[model samples]
Target: MIHAQTLVDAHLYPNQEAVMADALRALLHDKPQLRIELAIHRYQTEDLSLAQAAHIAGVSFDRMKALLLARNIQLRLGPADADEARKEIAEMERIIARRELP
Candidate 1:
């Protein structure tokens, strides 16, 4: 369980307190789909990993992957570094060379 307090300045609204209370109630109880959609959006934007988003959505990794695919959301493992790509290429070349020799 996490405890959080948000300070909102709704002075312009006539019934600020009531509006805020209703909004909070809707967010907490009537909007589970909204939470899942936000989690998926975060994953799509690379703000969260698939695992993190899955945890947020209370789903498995495979389920998250399927959801992303269903939504046409591309899964980014992480940013690819040039050095890492070069190292991977070199390793593959070495493996291929050894196979050719045998």
Candidate 2:
């Protein structure tokens, strides 16, 4: 194992190195596949890139994109856009529900 100082001396971004290793470790662990949609959503809202978010969530980039697509979530849209979409859907649902209420 390399010493922290030595790693630092190599002029690497500490957190980046740590997180990357963590992501790889987690992705390789024996376990059920994680829900990539939820992970991507959270990471997007928290300021992570698609690749970075995938790593942060410990999934492959391809897997993350596939999950987003399967869930009908657009990867190009920001979280704020997603929130607006959610609100619009909620309003539409409420209107529909009220129409049936007599």
- The global C-alpha lDDT for each of the candidates, from Candidate 1 onward, is 0.67, 0.60
**How do the residues 1-102 of candidate 2 rate in per-residue lDDT, one tens digit apiece?**
655556556777475567567556666464435535446667657554455556545567787778778777667543357776666467557655865896
TM-score of each: 0.46, 0.36
Q: Please, what are the lDDT tens digits per residue for candidate 1 over residues 1-102?
A: 312223334344345576577667678456767767878978877556666676666667798889889988888664378775665566557655765994
Worst lDDT 10-window in candidate 2: 29-38
Instruction: Estimate the TM-score for candidate 1.
Output: 0.46
Question: How many clashes in each candidate?
Answer: 0, 0
Error of 1 at 70 (Å): 0.3
Off by over 4 Å in 1: 1-30, 78-102
